[model samples]
Target: MDPRSPPPGDGRLTPADLRLWAVLGLALVFLALAALFLAAPALGALIYGVPAPEGIGRTALRAIGARDAALALYLAGLALFSTRRAVAIVLAASLVIPACDLVLILSAGTAAWWQVALHGVSAGVLALTALWLARRNHSA
Candidate 1:
């Protein structure tokens, strides 16, 4: 069989495909949250336990929202339209965001432990997902 052809049998997705779908779903959720942040920066700051300074805080939150929305859109696009290898590569590269988030939360002396922990957990999950996708694509 040609390696470029689809897998044998019906066109139903494999488990690995489902995992990619899950990742895409998660990205959509992230996009929605980013929109929320953009719409209500003060609310996002409250949730993250950050002080909502008059102007700077709102501006920063909006910037973060924009960054997150762009990242999420890029990831979702990869999952939806790219080859498995491409998705895996992008997923691996995307880990930087969560890793930086964890560090930023930790560096902010006033940030709650839970916030830091959340980012750490997010980083770990993204790393694991990327590894899984990469390995699966390689074995196929």
Candidate 2:
């Protein structure tokens, strides 16, 4: 057997493992953002290039964190109990949130180019992953 190749019976990839890894990757990002937004609003605001607010804004930041946490949890559930296509649909639908974030950051005017790019890249990655999963069509 060639060292570069998988065993004869084995395929080049284990898509189930790959899919789970993708879910974990996305979920971890959301969870981390949730923690950051909830625990350190000022620092989290800097991540999005938004001006940190003083009073009620802190509550708003926490609310955002809560939403991130919810999204992360939902992704976890989808990974465990749903098909890959189902997850892909959810992922595709979720792109709107990031798109909105990009718009909000752009409108704020304080966001640097990198900050704007971050949201755009996030949406792109999400769209790509969702398309990949849906095309794979692994239903079990």
Cα TM-score per model = 0.78, 0.84
Give the best candidate by TM-score.
Answer: 2
* TM-score (C-alpha) between model 1 and the true structure: 0.78
Candidate 1 lDDT, 25-138, residue by residue in tens: 768867986987799987776655466667776898888789879878877777766555566667788788878776666676667877777777777877877776656443
Total clashing pairs for each candidate: 0, 0
Per-residue error (Å), model 1, residue 45? 2.2
Local distance difference test values of all predictions, in order: 0.70, 0.80
RMSD of 1: 4.4
Q: State the local distance difference test value for candidate 2.
A: 0.80
